[model samples]
Target: MDQVKTYRTNVRIGNWNEDLRLEEDAKNEYLEKKQRGELAAQKVEVLKQNMLRPVDLTASSDGRLHFGDVVMLVNMGGENRARSTVSINADINSLNKTPSPAIQAPCGISAGQCVDACTRTAFIITSIDGSPEGSTLHFEQSFALRTTSGFAMGLYLSSDLQSFQKCSKKSRLQEVNLDDKCSFLTWWKILHFDPQERLEYEGQPVPANEDVVIIHCKTNHALAALGDQVLWTTYGKEYEVTAHTFLDSHKAEKDTNHWMLCTAENRLELLNQSQSTADNQEPTEANPGI
Candidate 1:
């Protein structure tokens, strides 16, 4: 914020020597751009970039998840053939078609678009609460997970909500545009392996980003990777994901339901946030029933 202010001030009244000041002939141009909000917008953009940049990662470099943290959702205990995390297939290459043409999810976007899990894709964990871009994320706090491309990790339910809420069908592990929204499908909450211990340490920093269950805020179901429901992608075969829960009392939550917001430290290149496009709007709070 201070940096942006300094930049704005410097641009308005030259901070350099007199030689660098706009000539008298160009002073009017500067005032016009400033009045048009162009200079203000540029300053805001700089502020966003600076605040969103990590001051420093969680000490361990792989744990202590924070809001706005770029990460890979690593599936550890699942029946996955290989260790991986949640990812989306933009289908930039023609290597794909709707794997399930007849099926659709209520995510309000391309329902059948491929969303698979692998280690390659990166995600940014965020919240619409207006925290200063990146802040420490606490346990049980409601937050939205999104791909850098601007698709938020969420699901939607039609009238027969339960019919479309399970991981068995329709692949409800879906993404919607990240804007001002209060939908339960897009808001998620994380829980520690021991719910009791979670409460015991309620406001404290969530230990390492390990052994957690990410539940859909509305349905109270878990984000699950269906290892068996594999799909072919530009990255080859990847696991299909969906919101799921165990029905039978005998069937407890399995490793398939467990996940880690594994750090993207190993990512060969850091995934930067996309520049805010015209679609960017003031985010409304998604705090209801949170």
Candidate 2:
């Protein structure tokens, strides 16, 4: 059996002859409040429905690790501001927590001040097979650079994930200033990598591939690159492009008939590369294309 939450509102409608402005305004506000309350209730209901994912785990006093136990750890305030790690029995979860930068106090600082100067964050899973005193596993977290003005952070890697060390001397991190008023970066992806593949490349000194592209919402300002070369970029949209993906043809080699699917301004569009003569090349619009 399941319990259902109910939301209710009360309102009184006066006669047409009685033109009371304050009464009408109060009625409208009450209606708006009811609508918002219903929406919030729905969101909470969704979260409650998905409760199979446990929020936390605890270990027993006697140091023994079970076969099928799950452990989740969270690190606070890294360069990315937050990171989470989940270990399941013998194998580690695919998600990798980003590492925090080393904290160093300036010279001439007192010992107490030096300790206060370090506000770093990190999480280490000492052992997955058994207790911390026995297992011999090591985990390496990734790195990201965050800026102060905006919520966007740089992934900073070589042009090619395969040959990333070639141009490693330059600054990999930089600010992404868009033309449109974007609130923040929503979602991003590298066209060629899958979840497991992404995890495999995490331990490498240089990333496995660098065909990087950032897709933003509120504006269709998507920037794509192949190796170190910038292939395309667009900006100035009233709504953020919340989601995007490259169409998969499921073949070996690159597929020529592929197109990118972008969602923005409450619409789905099939965006194709257009060889325009304009200063900034235009992406061909396939309207109402599912």
Q: Which numbered prediction scores highest in lDDT against the true structure?
A: 1
Q: Candidate 1: deviation at residue 266, Å?
A: 6.6
| Candidate 2 local Cα displacement, residue 82, angstroms | 6.3
User: What is the Cα-based lDDT of residue 56 in candidate 1?
Assistant: 27
The lDDT per prediction is: 0.50, 0.23
Per-residue lDDT, model 1, residue 193, is: 57
- Candidate 1 clash pair list: none
Please give the lDDT score for candidate 2: 0.23
Best candidate, TM-score: 1
